[model samples]
Target: MTKAANFIWYELMTPDPAGAASFYGAVVGWTIAAHNDAAVGGVDYRMIVRGDGGNAGGVLALGADMLAGGARPGWLGYLEVADVDAAIDAIKADGGAVQMPATDLPVGRIAMVSDPQGAHFYIMDPIPPEDAVPGEGGVFSVTEAQHVRWNELATSDPDAAIAFYKKHFGWGQEGEMDMGPLGAYRFLQRGDVMIGAVMPLMEGYPVPVWNFYLGVDDIDRARAAVTANGGTITSEPMEIPGGEYAMNAIDPQGAPIGFVGPRKS
Candidate 1:
């Protein structure tokens, strides 16, 4: 059987590439790299890196043509699957919609999918194998800077989202976490790995959306860097009851993202 999907890369589509690059560089200590052929639909792209010089993620220049077609500024998460065709079939069979059919890229094959509840994610089959043992550059590397540690899907129908993902991805339910009046948080596990999560959207929120969490060594420093770089901090830094410290923020173009520091036990 194929191993469960692993999240490998994330990219943000925003209106301002320079500003987004500057903001993220300060906040996450990323080194911004520009590519001559990074354009998709004719828009420029900027690559982000950790201070140690490893590629962390990417940002796209969302031009007017993109906005006119009804694209919103948001972060895109990529998960590694064993076979893109099989994943797309499972997704459609489970009632989810395919935003984009499987397309081949030099790096891998990719498909954009929306869950039954409307949260979007991309699945990929990297050119290189993804299930290689750790320390051998599997899907991601901790020594290169923190890889994606978690993905949270905020949706209107949490149960339906959970069912669809479980059917398509073979994720098992871990348990529910109480968020006071916000309702219950459902956690999922892939094999023995806890890759991401699903949660019901609170009242007054719009459609289902997914948020990506980038791991950091210091939460407070990350928060400070965000403010210093012209990004807005949507939430104040606070320790969750479980001991992790996190803060939500938006880049210069108003794309939602977050940073999390390890819990002190």
Candidate 2:
């Protein structure tokens, strides 16, 4: 089993699944396949199959019930936990809030939760195949185009948010960088790999949330495709510490996503 507190799944809830599929297919070269398993949630679930034959993520249409409840189209990542109910209790005890109670789904039991600073994510106990290898599903062998390369969190209170995750998810602080008046940008690790960082929410951010960055072959090329395919480019390619570059954007259905890749010299 993949250890608890590891980010195991990514899902996008959008009002237009077809449009999102087409826009992201162009953006990341993913081949979208409808998940029609009768045991599963049926037609609303669509799998994002990467060009290399690995499952990247899934696209779920925001249903009527969610819309009536004021749920907006967005992306949600799932962190694997040993016990869903136990994790939910810990989250609540630590001053976090539960948007949805733990419930049984076709693939697992999951609960939607928000951190103390209000960034939303899920805790799931997934049901994998009987013969599946441990630590295989939802993990990438290499950082490449079409795979999730990084995870970033912007929150109102970075210290409290980090402490909350550390308590329940076993997340460790690898290191941090002081960004002057913006405070410290803290790197988070599941074990060895630096999965992402947590920082204070920047100006103009709608809300505190986690943003996952998908890798691409070329950041410039991905930016071009995004604007040409009905997506809005929020930021151009900017070089980061790792020698590569990244950009952020909103998909056609209003869900924000990001891309990271090399820039041709």
Query: What is each predicted model's overall lDDT from 0 to 1?
Result: 0.73, 0.83
lDDT of 2 by residue, 164-218 (tens): 7777877887789889998888998877778889989998677899998998888
Q: How high is the lDDT of residue 187 in model 1? A: 82
Candidate 2 vs. true structure, TM-score: 0.93
Q: List candidate 2 segments past 4 Å from native.
A: 1-4, 34-37, 139-142
Query: Which one is best on TM-score?
Result: 2
Q: Write the per-residue lDDT of candidate 1 for residues 41-70, one digit (tens) a residue.
A: 344766676766566767777788889998
Report, for all candidates in order, the number of backbone clashes: 0, 0
Give residue 65's error in model 2 in angstroms. 3.4
- What root-mean-square deviation over C-alphas does model 1 reach? 3.3
Native-referenced Cα lDDT, model 1: 0.73
